[model samples]
Target: MRRNQRQAALVCVTNQYSCERLILAGKNLALSEGLELKVLCVQPPEYASGSYLAEIEYLFAVSRRAGAEMIVYYRDDPVRAAVTFIHANRIAHIVLGGVPDPAGSAF
Candidate 1:
């Protein structure tokens, strides 16, 4: 958290529209505050089959095109894994809306 160092902003998205909104807001915030932008999409364990893998790739490309580094991961318990990802990355701010917090955790 040094003055010269940049904080990271995490944008959690489930749908295309939300992802687009996050991209716009994330980029603007990053530009304004000099923070790094990261987009995270966590797929449920049940949806981790090959069929969904394609969507993951598509999202990855889309997020990158929107000007954020993207990370896609799978877990039976995404809440826990997302917490881990947030902590491990030392994210300073998180962007999300209308999405309920996972049952066992708060974000």
Candidate 2:
């Protein structure tokens, strides 16, 4: 794919240890669709210090190993930040973790 292509699979995550799965899911989806893979972490400014920093660094390394670049955004509203990133990056697909429901919902 060309470097200037806008379509990408965006994996959005919080400060959770289970984010590796999300990153891999995004990578697989991007591969299948011939799109770029991207990982995004949105956190508040309060969590910018201490252990959170270390966890972010680890996750960044994981993202790189998966052939994706991780982007970190410190914002008061995570949803807003994710939306901004989705638009700015021209994300075609989003990989997010949530509670599984027996009644499936449309994407």
Give the best candidate by TM-score.
2
Tens-digit per-residue lDDT, 52-99, candidate 1: 665567667777876788887777777998898887775788887556
As for candidate 1, its clashing pairs are: none
lDDT, residue 76, model 2: 96
lDDT of 2 at 1: 40
- Name the TM-score of candidate 1: 0.73
Q: Write candidate 2's Cα lDDT for 1-107 as tens digits.
A: 44486688999887777788889888889999998899999888888775587778888988999899899988899889888777677688999898667688654
What clash pairs does model 2 have? none
Clashes of each: 0, 0
lDDT of 2: 0.85
> Which lDDT values do the candidates have, in the order given?
0.73, 0.85
